[model samples]
Target: KIKEEINKRIKEKIKGILPGLLEEEIEKITSAKEEELKKGVERIIEDYQPLKEENKIITKLFRLLGDKTAYAAEKKPVEKTKIEIEIEWIELFNPYEVPCEVEGWQIKTSLGTRALGGIISSDSYRFIFNMVIRMPGKSIGKEILGDNGDTVILTNKRRNIVDKVSYRGYGLPWSAWEKNDPRSREFASILPGGSPGFRNWFWMPEVGEAKNKNDYSSFYVKDKPFANTGEIVFIHSGEWRTIRLEQGGEWQILDKITVADPPEKPVQGRININTASKQVLEALPGIDSALSQAIINYGNSKKRPFNEIGEILQILLLARLGSNGKDDDKDGYTDEEDEREAIFRGLSNLITTRSNCFTVISRGEVVKNDEIVAERKIKAVIDRGSSPIKIKYYRELSED
Candidate 1:
């Protein structure tokens, strides 16, 4: 009777404490939350016969512990940013296909992103934007917002979603992409330090905003802003129209394009390769009448002829063996496009497609009462056909 009573008490104790113990054990083993733990506990009890002493409830319970525990807290998933800044209504555009309507909308991008453009690489160049920016209601020169990792937002009085652009350049690089619907580009394919914003490529102001160019010219002029350098008239061999400067900055037809080299001397003499006849070509040192005719014929043959002086040299080199009928690129341009395109047009050297000025030098003696007193001469590009016959320069010459 004593053994029977003891066994009965033990059984009662196991039944009473075992449920609570199982709950605690399951909770510890599985990092599951309250709901998931409850479900798991019910499953274990239903599948294993807990009341039978001979059953492998303990063994099965141990096996359940090995079924991947979920004791650690769950990490929340990151969601995409839902801002209304990207616009994609237009069919085709630049950089990003769609343009943003930023009239009242204020931007929040790095200051470095405002204006950026230059030689993107040795092989190609990129042009962006150049602006003297001002905020509404702000003073002319007053400074405003836009630093790295700053939030760029556009909102009206109601705080309604107008538009927004945000970037994090405190770390890697990214590209500013415009699409109809936006999605974060996978970083796996992006290069380190890649920036994807208009104004935040390198975040150093050097890479420039996706919109600004440093204003380089293949052949630049003097006493003028970089903008004044005129366009080169590239005559296509096959077409009868001039190719735009926007079309041949890469010079796919010309093997190696050269820029405004070493800056033309301020008072330097420039010969228009396009209009210069055979005689004028002979006037330039190292050029003969044969090369001059070649230049003229090359220009006359194309619709938009000789947009670049480099093209002139290039064609001269190609025609060295004298017209082999070897049309490499099949684009009609055989040589120089004149002075319109400089590989830095307005930075230093000056060449032009048009010649409104002519430098004339008249050698004569300044005589005093018939005896030659002094020798004098002047070199200046005459401002020809103006209201007055303008003599461009006047100076004393050494008459020895």
Candidate 2:
């Protein structure tokens, strides 16, 4: 039946041939175009409902026909949908000499919105941490200040926006980057880290020459063999030690005495209090072996790591207030309030609760009829410490 139908259709297609053509010439032309006729027959059979009634006959007929032509309709190229996210910017533009209280201000990020407290001193910057802005029970580093990229929005107490900024995490931490500047955010020459609470290190501090003789003189006097009255100086014995001149102006150095070196020079850069080891913590000023161990203990005992630098004071206060010189969780302070405060204040600028880098993975897909037709994934390493943020590394990923 299929063969009869195909032959009838081919004859109908040949009916318009010129009258000059003989029967044999028409037969030759029809035979030469048999393949073309087959394709047309196949399409017609598929479209004709009556021909589709019998699945077996349809299948047999298609087998008799040739494979599809290259010109046949090709599947539509895979198209991916675009994803958009809302972002807000933050900027402070106060020129008043007096400090402005930012209490009740709000910071909105991709993760969520966080309220601000405390004052932003005139001509100074305040670095707020995720712990202060994130909702309770949220993780510190990943929640608000997205390690990969994020939009930051600042609103005043009246809910009016002050400023906003968007950044893609990429360059090294501590390096300065300005939006208007043509320079790249990633600086290969500078090491990782940044000046968060202060100005960028690229600028030099304005220092004037000493105006008075006293200002030019060194705090410690040298070249004088005999110590002056009420003078304190370092004496070299078996080990360097400090000696004071009494009322008689006489100073004696201890023989074969061992002493630790004086405090190290102040170092730049901040350490993540959430991840630093006890040994690393001890390297900071006012943090001795005992205090370092207390910090570690406090960090471990808590459900989460330190969310802000100020939280370290709670541990220091507990250590200072504990009885018998043992670390404890005592609630009140004693005569050691000043000492504890000194320790906390010393570390305020040297510690951070979040990491400098973050990894972000994003996947995109094209879907049809509830099934994924095409997919692509990307992995990026973002450096949040840089002023404008940087993408340290990026690569396309695949699913095995």
Candidate 3:
């Protein structure tokens, strides 16, 4: 009954203005845009069907207006709900600003939409969101924008669009991407090395610098060597640590990955796989102590040094690389390759023996729906070739 009452009132309002509105907008249909206008008019005309016999001119005039403006005179208007959401900051673009109030609003990206924890106070006039848009629930990916074109929409409780960002044609990526560095969201405004978050490391490639800065590294005795992180004998699968620099110019532990509840693969700047000790290898996913040993043994046995990281996948047969640069496992690939082709089968940014730069990829199991499951990849690079492995380049891989 309330809906009917609203519609009746809306119709009366439309009838009052239709005559003037039609005079302003009605046009002869010619091109595609004109045809679209005609269709919109026909939609409104349909609402007043009885007018076909009562008054043709009155019905035709409706074509000059939008469906809502023309047809409200005949049909009920469903009250469309509205919610106001303010885009606070885009981490890849405006990360330096204050974090957004993302409690209640829902964010949708090309990858998927995740709901906020509803932990924000909404008494203010606006809602802000610093949307990460990572996978929410059982969805597929978190890189929501598309290459050709994409739209990110913010909606309220009733799913009415509050705000949206739309882009068309092939443009810039949402984050920066370097050859061996993690493939970050290539935001249109962000260049390859420019940090949209207003921060970027000075590429320090010298090991002396890394040591001067008191960073961690494996001191090899020229072959039968191993690695340790100052305290641990060898890095464990979950032993990978995320560190940051302190004001005193020393490396400080920012967070450590817990085996029971590991964070998404912590990005490790490249640890020269060519020179990285077995202990270091053990810290990576799909690698146990035994596999690490085997990798070391295999390194000795190979005839030629790997030309590139992807070549190691072929040497270990972890992934069979055809000339075309794709994993051809359908012909019978197993083990890590068989387990998952996307991560294990390729070493695009890994497995380098000479560049003296390396990346460590780690994945952790997180409980989702009461079950432990694995998630995305992150990479970090350390260029030992530099006089002082400048700075460890680490970043989470964008899912686009």
Candidate 4:
């Protein structure tokens, strides 16, 4: 019986070992199949990589070509949305003997309705600003006068009436019209009418039915007061058409329109004396043609050629005394003396002499200073003359 039990135990062990051996063989076969499948997938991907790269390159090339073609297509040039006009005027003031260049002056437009008048009289045309208008493109039509005596009209290639509206000159302090004025109200009712909009007229792409009628009474001016100074230009059909006085006066169209460029500003290190023409002299403060000529004459008479601009003060004093300093006691100065001194004092800080030298007085000391304050050295001098003189010596220093 014992021998039979041992044989039975050995048979049970053999059965368990056979099952484990079969499981190991199955696992080996599964692993080999998985490796073969991975290799096959990698081979497929490697074979198509060049074709994918080629496709990407072709797509980029086509995109670039399409961009170039679109860029070359023709298109109409866009019209300018706004127009610019430069105005020039000769302003005059009272005491006609004073000189035209010395008068208060400015440049303006004609379409805007405002009046900048001081004293209204036939003789005291206290200020007359002779104006000239400048435009960029071709002129279509220009009207010197309009139904409203002061209004002027200008047009572009399309011949659209630029100044179809009218403005009243409200004299003196209240020199501009009210927004509720019949003309202003009517203009505001129209498509485009009010302050700056009035200058643009009703000629905008967004404007539809309102473009037909020429009347602009439905439009209203802005309630704001007129600007003390500025320009008003009329833009229509993508072109600059007309200019009006937006501030300081009635809309007086300037007929002397020209195409020349504006003058260049004066250079530094140079002195522009009042001796130049009306245009040149106007640049100086309180200088008019008469006064400018006077200044020129005084400059010429000085044999020393103005070592410094302060010499002008002395010259003006001399000129006021009829070219003699003898009247020093008449209070003892002439009207010319007072006028010259006043003018020099007004411009003492701004004006420079051709010699590029200036004088400065600190208390009782005469100090000579140079152009470059950074390297300036202080020195003192004394003079026993009636007028205490202070001199500052300076030269144009190198900018290292």
Candidate 5:
């Protein structure tokens, strides 16, 4: 019985792991002689039963094994992690065609870094393409701006931005403004700000007021009232500016500019099982392109949604693969289908009840060589359930 149980469990496991493989293939792999297979299965059950008795300990042991194995194997060679490709949004003057050049733009982040350089655009948003940078072998001592002005490196951390720096007096270096102008100096010294100007401008009104009139700046611009002040400022200007109310008064600067990132396109939604393309269906879990196509074909022929999962099993079974009665080859039922059908049948059988009749004998005396028996026994069987067996005159009768 133990062996039988193990064999059953092994069969179930094989069916689950390789649903596409035929039962014969599974049998070949397990290669257990009938009796040996049964013994092996029984042993597996015996081993598991004790563990099940101590469920908590067994579960923890398994989890620890998995974690430790993974940690220890971390040094082994692995496939490269997928890199997220950087997408560049270029500015176009025609709103359709790519731009020839973009000017007077600077990229900045919410962080304090400012003056991250951006490129020129005549058509769309101006952006650099295929930009790549490697990390330093050792940590850099302090934070410094990269050559493009769009990157800020601090120790091992680096940030990228999209915006062009606005030079004062055309050819003047960005560092020159740092000393002469407080706002320009602040913007250049800190991390890049959001589009138009440094992010600090939104918090510090004085900084917004200090930028050069012609230089572009970016700040957090909102139509709503400032958090500090319950009142809203509705000032409109052709150039970008950050407005904020300080303890002294409202501060607005003409040099402040706005910087905006390129808009992203919407993504396509999940594929419909009924009408999905082969590629779309193939992307689904546990489904291949061929299976997806087969599904479509089956659905088209039936002209309706499958009533139950079992129907698919039936279809696959009817389509079996090989010349042998048991061996289903290509274009026929897959091993997966058979396993699924078996599981479905098992579930269905569990709910069914048997009803039948039986008989029982009561009060019988045993005799040897025509001599009357000394002991008497009583037994009775009733038509209660499915099995029809003759009851011996020894056990108590059951009422039905």
Candidate 6:
């Protein structure tokens, strides 16, 4: 009877401890499985494509770590505005046959409106200065034009809108927007001191009318190599001779001098080789009239234009000879290839095969087992003239 009593007590004690141990073991297993599941989800979320609506559940669960980890995948870069130039004067052009009377008219800008009291002659230009248009109670000599962009509207005494123009200044010193084609109402940017009281430098008359280039003839040096002396050298004239600047910026041509040495610093602008005329090609150092013609002919022969600046070498070979591989230069060498190679190296940075403004599309893909798993595309507008070469526009294209 005594042994039976001891055995009953032992069984009760064993049962009590067994339930506790079982509960502890269950908790350990559940914790381990939950941790493994969480890690698997974390890996999936880490490699996920840029956040979409479908991944919100995973993104929220991942945020339990007290961080927005999903958004860190792709962060958009901050884009800055292009530098702008301020203007103190505004120009007005009259393209019609009859003159305009503006005694009781008003000119409207973003800042304020100024009363107009002058007559703009027919086929003429007029300039309004900043002091004349200063707003009332503002500081003396405030600029009328915005540094980045502005809209100028003109209205007559009857409050009828006469003309309005919207323009952006690209921070280029001494540049202004002027109508490029007098026949059309559209305007274009004119560089280096715009024509204030005369026709624009880039004015293109009607199709049959003779272009009056004499207005800008004083500023342009025809068929002359640049001397880095602040004078503008018009590149499209044939067989540019080396120009030496005399006193008062007068150009003295030296026929004996052929090649112009490269400037010490990289120039601000570049010419498109694909679109430049033969005369413009002659403007480069060591490129003569014969070479320029060869380039034009080579460009014409190719169905597709040059894709890169290096492709000019093929035309340079034709320039070595008269395109028939004969001794055209009469330098006693028929296929002397070194001369053309030197020219290519000299003109590389100054020339481009494309325009100043172009679009760039970039794509990226994740592939697995010969199949695309994920893909992304981005499009941007690249303006080469802008300083620091920032993207003017950007967008994420939907995957097709």
- Candidate 3: stretches off by over 4 Å: 1-181, 184-268, 277-294, 300-316, 321-346, 354-400
* Model 1 quality (TM-score): 0.23
lDDT of 3 by residue, 1-400 (tens): 2223223333333333323334222221112133433444454434333323433222112221222221223323332221111111232221111234454667787766757434333212122222111111221113344547666677767788755666555344333221112221222332332232222221111111112224554221223221111111122222232121212211122123122123343334555566778867755533555556766777678855544343343333332222324323322222211222222312223333455556777555578898866566677877665565654787777543
Ten-residue segment with the worst summed lDDT in candidate 5? 64-73
Give lDDT tens digits, candidate 5, residues 136-221.
Answer: 12211222233333322211113332223332232223321121111122333222212221112222222122135654333335
TM-score of 4: 0.21
lDDT on C-alpha atoms for all candidate structures: 0.33, 0.45, 0.36, 0.30, 0.31, 0.48
**Candidate 6: stretches off by over 4 Å:** 1-87, 132-138, 180-190, 205-400
Q: Pick the candidate with the highest lDDT.
A: 6
Judging by TM-score against the true structure, name the best candidate.
6
Residue 256, candidate 4: C-alpha displacement in angstroms: 44
Best-first order by lDDT: 6, 2, 3, 1, 5, 4
Instruction: For candidate 2, write residues 336-383 as lDDT tens digits.
Output: 222223334235445667787778999999999999999999999998
Which residue ranges in model 4 land beyond 4 Å of their true spot? 1-271, 274-294, 316-340, 355-400
Error of 1 at 378 (Å): 1.8
Candidate 2, superposed: residue stretches over 4 Å from native: 1-269, 274-307, 316-318, 321-335, 341-346, 354-356
Which whole-number lDDT from 0 to 100 does residue 361 have in model 4? 31
How well is each residue in 127-159 modelled by candidate 6, as lDDT tens digits? 665421111122223456676778888899998
lDDT of 4 by residue, 18-38 (tens): 233344543443343344334
lDDT against true structure, model 5: 0.31
Full candidate order by TM-score, most accurate first: 6, 2, 3, 1, 4, 5
Evaluate model 1: give its lDDT: 0.33
lDDT for position 235 in model 2? 39
Model 3: lowest-lDDT 10 consecutive positions: 201-210
